[model samples]
Target: MLAVAAGCGGGGTGADHSTMNRRDGSASPGAAGHNDADVMFAQMMIPHHRQAIAMTDLVLSRASSERVRSIATQIAGAQNPEIRTMSGWLRSWGEKVPAAGAKAGGMDMADGMMSDADLAKLKAARGERFDALFARMMIAHHDGAIAMARDEQSDGRDPDAKRLAGQIVRSQTAEVRTLRGIAGGR
Candidate 1:
């Protein structure tokens, strides 16, 4: 019994402790849950969504048009939950969520994000000008999201991840049209 207990102790040889299955039922070490596609999608997307939300918040604070503010609120609201959902996926997969400041630093659509200068410019504008800028910038941001979503849809193997990407594409495409109309350019 002592030998058995000792064997089960610090240097246990029954099984590899390093490759144990997690409580969340992700997978054993030898198995893959999501994949690099899922990891890349989530990692790249979180900050992209964050930037969109930041833009939306800027307009929500000083937007003159009820329509624009309403749209900004909606965009922020929808994307916030999606960010949490994607983060949850990363957590379940035992992956790290990328920081907002982390450079996506890749050839992906996330690289097309707005510069700090652009955000500063947005923060400085107001009234019809602000509406115009917000519409134009958000249109571009939505386009970037659509591009990323399309990539995920094409490459992602996970069913839920692909479905969410499709949702982002459809919803953001519609929003692009709506924002363009609001910008008086449609």
Candidate 2:
């Protein structure tokens, strides 16, 4: 359920909205003076972060790289609170949080969510290999999140949601760079 009524504080970088995004991946009239984009952003990002947290948990249980664990710690710290913030948006919006019933969909819309199998593999890996896998998987996941945030910035109308989306883009983009550095031993 997307809370449609919450206001936002200033956060993150601004988005580039040269075009509008619709669920169909085509341009629309930009939520047409509604907070649909905020709802959508919250709804989509929840599941995305959930998967990320799950992946982080996997590495933390078995990782040998202090750097990898540290990165995972940071990612979890940033995203977990974001989930709460978005949940607040849904509550304030008076929208039902997604999947209030099975009829409602979940955050399946986020970019590169890991599967149980991927998690299993990570659990089975060791040492630098675990770090490598975590970095690679997280990079993909962040890229997906970046795409979704871009969409929200372009098509979302709520000022706060747009602001959050921009923040997500900047923060996750920097994280992606950091992960790449980890991958390259920088």
Which residue runs of candidate 2 sit more than 4 Å off their true CA positions? Answer: 1-34, 99-110
TM-score of each: 0.78, 0.74
lDDT of 2 by residue, 14-51 (tens): 44333333323343453433355556677767767767
All predictions: root-mean-square deviation over Cα?
12.3, 9.2
Best by TM-score: 1
Q: Rate the local accuracy (lDDT) of all candidates.
A: 0.67, 0.66
Model 1 steric clash total:
0
Q: What TM-score would candidate 1 get against the native? A: 0.78
Which regions of candidate 1 deviate over 4 angstroms? 1-32, 100-103, 107-112
